[model samples]
Target: MLIDTHCHLDFPDFAAERDDIVARAHAAGVKQMITISTRVRKFPEILAIAEKYPTVFCSVGTHPHNADEELDIPVSELIELARHPRVVAIGEAGLDYFYDNAPREAQAIGLRNHIAAARETGLPLVIHSRSADEDMAAILTEETGKGAFPFLLHCFSSGPELARVGVELGGYVSFSGILTFPKSEELREIARTVPLERMLVETDAPYLAPKPFRGKRNEPAYVAHTAAVLAETVGVSAEEIARITTENAFRIFSKMPRV
Candidate 1:
């Protein structure tokens, strides 16, 4: 069985056929998925989606792009919402200098707040990092110094240093369809360095679809493609990659029930 540890099921892209999309994931061997949150205000929509699907779970927190808008959301609020039975993680939050959609300061603040919530709730923080690797690593290192908290670097596409730091800090690294892109040889090299026990796979769907399906609307079902490439990159069998990543997902998102 495979688990898509990151996706956006609440987005309108899947509205017309959300049921079918989920069924396709199951049919493709993706047994579980976590519909990630991008805005704390839209958490109701995220939660409703998770509530609707027995195998779908969710996280609570804002994406860095919307950090400015939700800067006022306290760590307590995130902790409270995460208490829901279906909420398995704390965020899709982190730095995104590539977009700079929100103020960098606001993004940093939001990230720290989410980290605090993750610490308090014992839920893994689903981090979304982009070109801000240095700052992201700095914050993660500083925060971890205060007290350790579980986190996963979702959709990882950063430098080797960030990947190294994440693993050194005892965090998991989740790869998206980006891993399957022809030009991602550098990324594949980075993946080679990360420990298999600390690696995960996600689609970050409605966005990055892997090769053979690139330029298409991605869904959880396509996660297998990324996993295949990851397995090949890390010199493991397809089934072994699936087993290793699934186990890593369960370990980080411990809040989710095992199948």
Candidate 2:
């Protein structure tokens, strides 16, 4: 069995066939999926999806891109909302200098708030970082020094330095369909060196479909393709990759019921 630890089922791309998308994922051997949140105000929509499906779980926090829009969202509110049974993580939050969708200062402040919620609730932080490695590394290092919090670099596409820092702090790295792209050889190399115990896999769907499905709509079903290449890169069997990532997922998202 495979677990797609991160995805966005609430995105309109799946609006027409949301149930079918999730059904196909189960048919393809993905037994569990976590529909991640990007905006705190969308928690009801995210929660409704999770409540409607037994295998789907969710997270609650603002994406770095929308940080400015949700700056008033209190850490206390995030912690409170996370009390829902199906809400399993604290964020799809972090810095994204590549887009600069939100002010850099707001992004940093939002990231820190989400980190605080994760630390307080004991739920893992689901993070996204791009083109902001220097500040990301410094912040994670500073945050780790203040107090340890569980986290994973979701859809990881960063430098070796940040990857190493994440592992050093006992956090995990989740690879997506991007790993199957030919230009991602460097990323595969990083995957090779990352300890298996600290690795996870996701599709980040409604985007990043792997080879054959590349440029098409992605869903949890295609996590198999990413997992296959990840197995090849890490010198492990496909079944072993399945076992390891699933084990790691359960470890961090401990709120999920054992299957």
Candidate 3:
């Protein structure tokens, strides 16, 4: 069974035909999916999606791109929202200098606060860092010193240096459909270097669809394409890639039930 570790089924892209999309995911061998949260105020919508679908789960926290909007969400509220049985992770949060949609300082503060919530709740934090490796690495290192909390760099597009820092800090790295892009040869090389035990696959669906489907709307079903390409890049069978990555996901998101 395959697990699409990061997806956004809660987004409008799937609103008109979610059941059909989910059915396609099952047909494509995806057994479960996690709907990532981008804003604290929008978490109930995320939760509603998860609760409505047995195979879907949810994460709670703010995305770095929306950092300014959720800046006021307290550590207490994050912890409270995460207590829901369906909320198995915390974040889609981290620094994103690539867009600069939110202030760098605010993004940094949001990341640290999410880490604190993760430390408190023991839920793995789903991080998204882009073009801010130095600050991202520094914050992860500092947060680890305060208290170790589980986390993973979701849809990782950062440099190899940060990938090494992530593994060194005892975090996992999840590659999304972006890995299948022709220009992503370097990212594929980085994927090959990350230990199999600390690797995962995601669709980041409603975004970044893999090659052949690159320009289209993405969904959990397309995770197979990313996994297949990653397996080829890592010199492993697609089945092996699916097995290990799903296991890695379960290991980091300990709230998941053993299957």
Candidate 4:
């Protein structure tokens, strides 16, 4: 079974047919999914979704885009929320220089706090980094020096250097539907270099749908397409890729119960 390690099931895009969406994922062999958190304030809603679906899990913490809005959220609060049985990870949080939706300093501060929470709780931090590889790499390295923490560079589309830094820091790398794009040869090459054991696949729906599904609303079901491309990129069979990524998912999101 494949695990969609990162997705936003609480988003309105899935509200109309949420049940159908989950059913499709199951039919597609996506046995599990972690609906990531973008705002600590809305965690109750996210948690509600997880509670509704037996196969779904959740995370707690703010996204970098909304970091400034939740600056008052302490690491202790994140730790407390993560104590929930359904909350399996922390923070779709990190630097997002591409949008600059939140102040860079605020994003950095929020990331550090989330990292601390992950370190303390032994949960994986679902990091969302974009157009800030240098800063991302520096912060990850600096934080690891403070002490190790489990993390996944979610929806990675960064340069090879950042990928190398993430792997070297013992962080897992999750590829999104972007991996199936025709012009993503560079990303595929990076995937080739990453150890299969440290790799994961996600859809980040409702966005970045893979290949034939591109421009359509994405869902957990489409993670299989990315997994197929990752298999080709890494010289493995599709079944092998699914097995490896599912294993990697449970390894990183250790709080998630096995099926």
Q: What lDDT score belongs to each candidate, Candidate 1 first?
A: 0.95, 0.95, 0.93, 0.95
- Kindly report which residue stretches of model 1 are placed more than 4 angstroms away from their true locations once superposed: none
- How does each model score on TM-score? 0.99, 0.99, 0.98, 0.99
Per-residue accuracy of model 3 over 34-145 as CA lDDT, tens digit each? 9999999988899999999898999999999999888888999999999999999999899999899999999999999999999999999999999999999999998899
Prediction 2 TM-score vs. true: 0.99
Lowest lDDT sum, 10 consecutive residues, model 4, at: 250-259
Query: Per-residue lDDT tens digits of candidate 4, residues 56-128?
Result: 9999989999999999988999999999999999898899999999999999999999999999999999999
Q: What is the lDDT of residue 110 in candidate 2?
A: 98
Tell me the deviation in Å of residue 199 in model 3.
0.5
Q: Give a tens-digit lDDT track for model 2, residues 60-90.
A: 9999999999999999999999999999999
Question: lDDT tens string, model 1, 189-230?
Answer: 999999999999999999999999999999999999999999
CA lDDT, candidate 1, residue 245: 95
Candidate 2 residues lying further than 4 Å off, grouped into runs, are: none
**Against the hidden true structure, what lDDT does model 4 obtain?**
0.95
lDDT, residue 49, candidate 2: 97
Taking all chains together, the TM-score of candidate 4 against the true structure is 0.99
**All candidates in order of lDDT, best leading:** 1, 2, 4, 3
